[model samples]
Target: MTIDLPEYPFPQPTALEPPAEWAELRAKCPVAEVRLASGDQALVLTRYQDVRQVLSDPRFSRLLNADDAARVTANESGGVFGSEQAERTPVGEGHQRWRRLVGRYFTAKRMAAMQPRIQAMAEQLLDEMVAGGAPADLVSAYGFPLPVWVICDLLGVPDSDRVKFAYWSDHMLSLTRYRQDEINAAQLEFGEYIWAHIDAKRAEPGDDLISDLIVVADAEDGQLSQMELIGTAQGLLVAGHETTANMIGKMTAMLLADRDRWEQLLAEPALVRSAVEEALRFDANPGFGMPRYLTEEIEVSGTKLPPGTTVISSMAAANRDEEAFDNAGDMDLRRTPNPHLAFGAGPHSCIGQALARTELQTALNVLLNRLPGLRLDGSPEELPRREGLIIGGLERLMVRW
Candidate 1:
């Protein structure tokens, strides 16, 4: 059952709408070929089970720098996907060890403890947004800054340098947005800044993720090499800030896009937790799905994939599979026992998920409590999405209260 390979990330009619091809592909060709921005071809998995299987399987690796692996973007550097830092990132046992060491800080309990601080930050940002007046772009005013502030605090990064951090992060994760030279320059500058920051932390440690990791590294006597340490910081800074920031805006937009959803939340505040999870599950534009380079032959959805093949798991598509969820297309605020692959799956699942969840829940709570009248200032369908980035998100969430 072979079909023409459509461009990967099939086009969407609107910012909030899912691509029509997601359903078609999932039903007809669960395992199908697609072309990447780099003009390389790869197979995309659209079924729920197959997507999760490939992600959790150890045979499918994140080592996308293999000579034969398909480049993810048009840029020669491969953006973050094929970057030197990504190549150096530990895999297998070494990767698990790195996760164990850093996972301690992101546990549910720790995120729960950090909730108050996150709430305070959200409130302050909301206050400033309110003071500035309505018809505001929530993406810039509220969504962007909140997560950056949280990540800065977590990494002990100076808040004053957030502008620079944002710039570096953009180039690092960009798919078609930045040129190769610009990406290289940004990486160099970021590396130098992180190294200097590490030196400063070594001289004077603080109660932050990086400082704590440094102490452990020092105690373990180079258990984590300097490169690993720097990569850890850079990875956390980018992942922590970008995904959650986009999500905050998207979640709010999803709720307000339907006034009924907002009214339901206002009526039943207990649904906030489940609502956040649902928003994650319901997000249609979550950017490029996870890419894994196969080290061994594998068959997915009856399609045989050979070694040295690059396969993309379209979690967004899987989330909407009717075979996976009841009435999968509808956004049910009360959808309980919801499990979605928004953070990915298996060993490589997002380490900062707890923190992200906390921030989102807190943001929603604060928005509901303070701006009970919050409503979309424009049509959700007309909203613009951020272009030329690996991650997908709204460009601006126009709202007024």
Candidate 2:
């Protein structure tokens, strides 16, 4: 049975709800062609197993040719984040070296040690929320700032410079309000800012990620060049902050909207981890899974995808595949052995998964403990979802206790 996939202006999915049409597409054709915003044909992998295999399989390369990459973005120019150049970086040796250099700071052990600090930051933010009274915008009061603060502290970025960093990061990740000139300018500004920070670290080395990167660079016989260092730092700054912040806001809003779930979490705090996993599964905006171009003709899930075809693995769709989970649409905090790809799989899997989990777990625990009667201040339907672009989240979430 052929199904007509919805066109652009499609309703953005939320942490609390999947797009209404997802189930239909999953049932009919798990692997189908999607017309991207750029009006180019890109393969969309909707099934859990198919998406996972595509994400992990090296046959499908993330490196896109200049022409294909440009076509992927509606702007006809390059993307806001310099994704074109990012993908061009050699995925074998160069990528591994880069990942190794930064891995020291993002290790699971180090993130585990950061739980107390993250919890402290969460409490401080929640305290201010209570002081601000009901009808407070959680995004501004807590969501936006918590992850930025934590990541900045971890990377040794000065608190005062966070505002500037935040601006550049937003433009870099934003799909709307971006032009070629703006994207280029932001890249240059961010590069300069990171270089300056690296210089300062060189003068007085501190116990931070930047300082550690410098040490590794010097020891590796200068394997990491100046541009690479700055680029790596900038990438961490954005990923460490934006994605986690969105998850925090969306998760909080979802819990508050469902009083039973909120009470369930409060009564049994041990469910926080499972709750976070469910939140990741339900939050449908990670800017679309990492895009890959077929290097050679390959068949995925019985569909013939020719060489040069762009493939997009939808984490939102995969998480909700009925074949993967029973009653996939329902939010079950008790879901054991949950195998969701909220974090992409394989070599490109999120390097900071541990840190992100720590942040989410900490935020939920503190919010539930402090705001037992927490509830949404406005109707859930009224909160507009950020659409057309990637990274699904609410524009603003107001809450009252």
Candidate 3:
């Protein structure tokens, strides 16, 4: 049956605005059909409760490599969706074990301890940006490098190799950008690089996550396989670098889009934490949301979804659902008890969330303290949206102080 479904990433008037379809879908068609970049159809959950349920439930699995699952992209290998690394990721009990191994390093206490270093990195980036003078592209000047440096330090990755990491990440995140061959080559290159790095780490372990994982894996009896080790390193590098990098850019753009928001934070420094949460919840362009494949027949929002169904949970959409938050459209910097799903939900929620939060809070504080005069160099509507990636971000966030 040929279904005339609207495209998955609905058209937006600007980079920082949500698609009109999100509000409409939540209102009338909470569970709506949409076509992906691969031209395959999947059901998207826009309502807060439905999205939360799908993500938190065990039945909606990340096993998108199934033969019957809808491919997320048109690439022959489905980009990151059906990549070997994704396939190698542990599931069920194995997944729980994997999370346990990685989660220990990302606890709130550890992230808090690392805040000073994160703040220093942010300060250095901001100093460099200021040295370059005004009308700078914040995305390039401050946003991208901060998270890259932090993640690289965490993984024992050399700072000199950041350019390559960026390239490999972009290729792996292809939605409609690179050709199949290009994507394949990038993955191969990234895998080879990670393997080589792992070999180096094995010989001389360092005080980093990769080295720590190597030690743990060596001690464990069949707990983390060699492939799992490689997948873990690769996954951390990409997830730790890409999403956070894009978010720093998006978060800054959101604040500067409204001077009052920026002023609000500067006036009440205590609001930094809550403001970051609000920004996460209020983000209109968070790129391709988390995708889950159904393992069995299930009902969501009174709709029955059968086995083999591929459902995309629009966390960004759900974050803005009126039913979930008071004045869902308003950006409340003081919003308390804010339980936004920006890091996702359930067992599969982002493990590095604490680290992400630390980086974000540190970055915002450093910026507000150092450059209270900061303002956008261009209008919000004039900003260009980054294209061809599952994650959404601004191509360039021009700013001045």
Name the 10 consecutive residues with the lowest summed lDDT in model 1: 73-82
lDDT digits (tens) for residues 1-401 of candidate 1: 54456887778898889999999989888888898876778888888999889978976676567432222321111111112222236777877778888888889999999999999999999999999998899989889899899989989998778789779877876778988788779888998999999999999999898998888777756668777888788777777777788888888999999999999999999999999989988988888887888989988887789999988888888889898889999999999888787777776776777888898999999999999999999788899998887777888999999
lDDT for 237 (candidate 1): 74
TM match of model 2 to true structure? 0.90
Q: Sorted on TM-score, highest at the top, how do the candidates line up?
A: 3, 1, 2
Model 3 TM: 0.94
Q: Which digits, one per residue and each the tens of the lDDT, describe model 3 over residues 1-401?
A: 78788987787789889999999999999888899887888889999899889878976677567432212321111111112232236888887888888888889999999999999888988889899988899888888898889989999999789899889878877788988788889889998999999999999999999998888778748788888889888877777766777778888889988999999898999999999888888888877776788989889999999999988888888999888999999999999989888877777777777888888888899989999998888789989998887767788988889
Sorting all predicted structures by lDDT, with the top scorer first, yields 1, 3, 2
Candidate 1 vs candidate 3, TM-score winner: 3
What are the models' TM-scores?
A: 0.94, 0.90, 0.94
Which segments of model 2 are wrong by more than 4 Å? 1-9, 13-15, 65-90
- Give candidate 2's error at residue 197 in angstroms: 1.4
Q: What range of 10 consecutive residues in model 2 has the weakest lDDT sum? A: 73-82
Error of 3 at 67 (Å): 9.7
